[model samples]
Target chain A: MGRSPMNREDTTKNRILAAAGPIFAQRGFQQATVREICDAADVNLASINYYFGDKQQLYIDSVILAREQRAQQFPFPSWSDDTLPEVKLRKFVGMLLKRVVVMQTIPWQVQLLMREILNPTEACRQLVEDYFRPIFDRLLRIVDELAEQPLTDLRRTQIGFSIIGQCLHYRFSAGVISLMVQEDQREECFDWDELTHHITEFSLAAIRNLGSHVAVKSSPRTSETH
Target chain B: MGRSPMNREDTTKNRILAAAGPIFAQRGFQQATVREICDAADVNLASINYYFGDKQQLYIDSVILAREQRAQQFPFPSWSDDTLPEVKLRKFVGMLLKRVVVMQTIPWQVQLLMREILNPTEACRQLVEDYFRPIFDRLLRIVDELAEQPLTDLRRTQIGFSIIGQCLHYRFSAGVISLMVQEDQREECFDWDELTHHITEFSLAAIRNLGSHVAVKSSPRTSETH
Candidate 1:
């Protein structure tokens, strides 16, 4: 009854999500307007209600769409393959950084996700658990295997943050980063290749240095004193 | 005349900023309303209009207030002391992460700053540059010296991201992180000490490795050759 190869409901829903991607990225979920999304998609305001049931659902769908796109573009290879753990770790870091930065495939979606992390909405909570959390867990496992010791959940989570943070910082704060580096010669600007390399190497070293005792102790005292 | 301070303008401005601090941390800048701020401070709404001129300015003042507090905490002596680079770096990472995670000293200003970074109002542009950028640049230099290389700006920046990402990821995604570690037998789920150790080691290794590059350049037009 809908268009060929797609249900009418699914097609309309996808269109709404696609339209929301950039707006949410550009202006956070708090600021994005439903009317603007409808206008951008060239669909009736009622289409959102019919397909997804609410504005919040549309946003969740948009986040899912972006996550799928990122996963596809940077497909997670089986670490079961013969590559060394370090090499596998490096390649994964490279692929992630490339997809996250050079591609800019889902810039706004990523920003929206960050917005949720910084200031959670009910919608962000749902998507983060179902979608991003699993991927992060798996990635942490991979890094832990390459690491000197098995990590505590807290350590695993911290490593996950480090890898992602290094890769996404420039893209997430492109304007601020550009300004910060403006005084450097034009030839010395940030490059994706070099950026990925540094992140891979730095993160690897940091993980390898984590002691075996990390899983047992929980102290408010900082590592800075060392 | 203002209540008690020598300078009435400074008193009023500081009061407005002081009131704005917890409100912004709790509600975020966009969600924080002027009336709520006025009510909390026990000051007239007109005073805000009179002194800072607008809601955005009050927000900036609050951010600056928090930033100044943090800057005063991370003194240059922390880095420039006779301690070895690795020791200094670990200490710095631990100190910074503790400050970010503890929630009392620095508050949640970092999250607010990051949100503004993602979605900047004109007011935040200069504030970010003035407060955060220089600190990051200093971080880059510290990372560079630790690595013992004349790192390219790209390399330094990448390492900078790694350190921060590793450090801040736990607090930023506390919801997911808490869940990830909740199953552990440890009575206190979030282990700050262990997290700091893992991140410091991971970051140090990554930075150390950046100085050495071993990847062979492949021919641009080769069909396939190892």
Candidate 2:
């Protein structure tokens, strides 16, 4: 059990992060103000300064906290497990989708992190290295184990890019996706279990056929220019 | 030949769009000012108001112009032509990557548009339908022809989401990707031919496997239960 003061400190910091997540998600980093954050957290402005220095540092802390929460919720799978590669990949996908889609659990800090990705700042580079790259490397190792021809690191990286690309498009283009699919509930449509099943089946097929070195016989060059 | 005044007017509009694309890309919509746009275009601020009703409309028009230029450069294969599905898909991927990857293009507009999607505006809804839905629909039809399962409309929509997801990941996570991938020229690593080949092959494998309906065997539940 934690001491009373320690628990209070933890609770206060978490409350600030929880409040900041959605606001940062909605308004973005530059647009969001320190006063607004303090108000949202129901804490004095001094508390934030005391705990995390300034607004920029507070924002960074919020992101770090969210990232930690995500990791804890969806910890990296053990490589030693005897699970089939397909099943492992599917679970990974499901966990990822759930983390991204469930707004109640996810803080707005993630949305801010994504913003930095599209238009990066100096801070984003360190964030990526510390938090994101390892997860991808883990993903690549899993794909390599499953692939037919033993994917080169380069190829695995590309596949990783593709897998993530497919997953994130829904989050990035929710409005267009809703219109195209005729779904009233956009958030609901990104159902984790269902999407995980679909992508796993799809991505596994893609990886299985890769690096087989099979000759793709093209139609005779009609122009004969070459 | 066009009359001199009309030619001048067209040229001025083109110049404004050209300048605005880079400026808008560097600084997002909120930050990008009419004064900055006019300064970059080497025109009076009054010219922007004359050419397009206001700054918002000007930005939209600039994006449209960029899209038109992309369509011209990477014209879609004629549906009338008896092209192979794989060939068509590969070409489509190439066209999409080329269009989206460029620093100066409507693809940059796409980045701006993505920001709005995370935190939508009224404008995002209309823009989604007008600009983006049609693109997904076109891609879906191609996947439909290739997929072995006779995929339902919902499945096709999901697949469409995945394709876009993978393709756009580069722009979406540019900073992180550059750091993580061990390449000399980080940007140049997104090779169109290679990437398109991988995506097309991966998508094809996934589509082909849909016919089999082989469910992956599950592993024993992990100790860390949610």
Candidate 3:
């Protein structure tokens, strides 16, 4: 009897989190209500309060859970010891595009993260520290390796942003893009492989061309090592 | 007396628009209320109904006005006959970064537009057609000039998005960026001139490197002309 009740409680908690992710993503923190979340979850109104303490707590928990789920679903591509920087970059860009644009199976997590980014609330701080910072650091390392010259941290960061910005544009402004392009062009632009290829090619060309210029001011570390 | 009353009415109308722009931008269309707007504007609540027909109309008018104001404030740089494609591209990127990141005197316009983009309402379609499309078309023309070989319209559009995506990232994710970079690096990154130089160099290098590849599959027009 005790085990049955505990399992039921766990089920209700999981259900509430699943329901809350989409609602909070769609409505944002200020607009989403606990009642709506409970109704969507098919749990009693009191269940949220019992399980998560309050609506804010539930929202935070839901965001964290969604981040974990997304990371697992589209984990970063790992490079082997012999992998070339160019190959690693292509894979990185492809993985990022997949995470942003092609993952139609579970889009709520992306939507939720985008919503937080646009209209950030308290949970945004945690989301950035826990979820985004590590990914950013990894991207920086990849960019550093790709550079022919030792880049200033600032330069590396800007390059990383440029690459990420291209991928994110498709997600945030798909409607605007579709409206701007010709009807036929829209179909071509949205093709997953085509868009990924364009971005990777575009970024690689820039990185290769600019890498020499960036190395113009060699770091002390380079001189010392040489 | 007739002109005076008319001028007073016009003043009242403008006041409502100015007040509503920030509110609608901050709270979005659904959440922003007429009463709050009236309170902020220090106008009679009836004035909104009397002047603009409804809150939606007022919101639309404010958006239009803000767009006009922004365009006038930061008009796109005009290229001379003697300007090189490389120079023009650099100028275009610099001007765009200025429009997006440096013009902080009045940020409400950018914020309003971004909010509409993230959670597009009916207003977004008109905004894109009237405001964004012209700018996009201009960008396409610029990108076309920079390419060694003629680019497909779709390729031109993707390149434009890539350029714009970099500029918009700073505005939308300033918080996340500030968190990611070191405190001193943040200061350097946000320096309008330094950031503009970096983005321009980054984009130009990429465009130059990718231009030849983009021309590999010539469009029907190229074949026809040849």
RMSD of each: 4.7, 5.0, 6.4
Off by over 4 Å in 2: A1-18, A42-54, A77-80, A102-107, A184-188, A211-226, B1-18, B42-55, B79-81, B102-110, B113-122, B185-188, B213-226
Give, for candidate 1 chain A, the lowest lDDT window spanning 10 residues. Answer: A209-218
TM-score of chain A of 3: 0.85
How should the candidates be ordered by DockQ, best one leading? Answer: 2, 1, 3
Of the candidates numbered 1 and 2, which has the greater DockQ value?
2
Clashes of each: 12, 5, 0
**Candidate 1 TM-score versus the reference:** 0.79
Better of 1 and 3 by DockQ: 1
- Give the Cα error of residue A105 in candidate 1, in Å: 8.1
- Fraction of true contacts retained by every candidate, in order, equals 0.49, 0.60, 0.57
Per-residue accuracy of model 1 over A1-226 as CA lDDT, tens digit each: 4544753454666678778898987776667888898999888989888888887887777777776666666576565566577766666666666555634344665566666665566666566677667767667767867767666565566567677766666555665665566565323345555565556656665565444324344555654444
Models sorted by lDDT, best on top: 3, 2, 1
What DockQ does model 3 achieve? Answer: 0.38
Q: Taking the candidates in order, what DockQ does each have?
A: 0.41, 0.46, 0.38
Residue by residue across B1-226, what tens digits does model 2's lDDT show? 5445552364767678878876775676678888898898888889888888778887776555555555567565454456666666766666677667645334555555555555555566665676667776778878877765576665777777777777777766666787778766455356555666666666666666654554332322322231
User: Which residue pairs in model 2 clash with each other?
Assistant: A21-A108, A165-B165, A165-B166, A166-B165, A166-B166
lDDT, candidate 2, A1-226, per-residue tens: 5435553365767677778877776677777877888898898888777877777887776667666666787676554478778767876666666656544444465566666666666667777788778778778877877876655555677888888777777666555566666645454456565576667766886676544532242322312111
For model 3, residues B1-226, the per-residue Cα lDDT tens digits are 5344453365887788879999987788878999999999999989999988988888878887778877888788886788777677667766777667734343788778777666566777898898888888877787888878788677787888888888888877776777778887878777666666666777788888897654453332211011
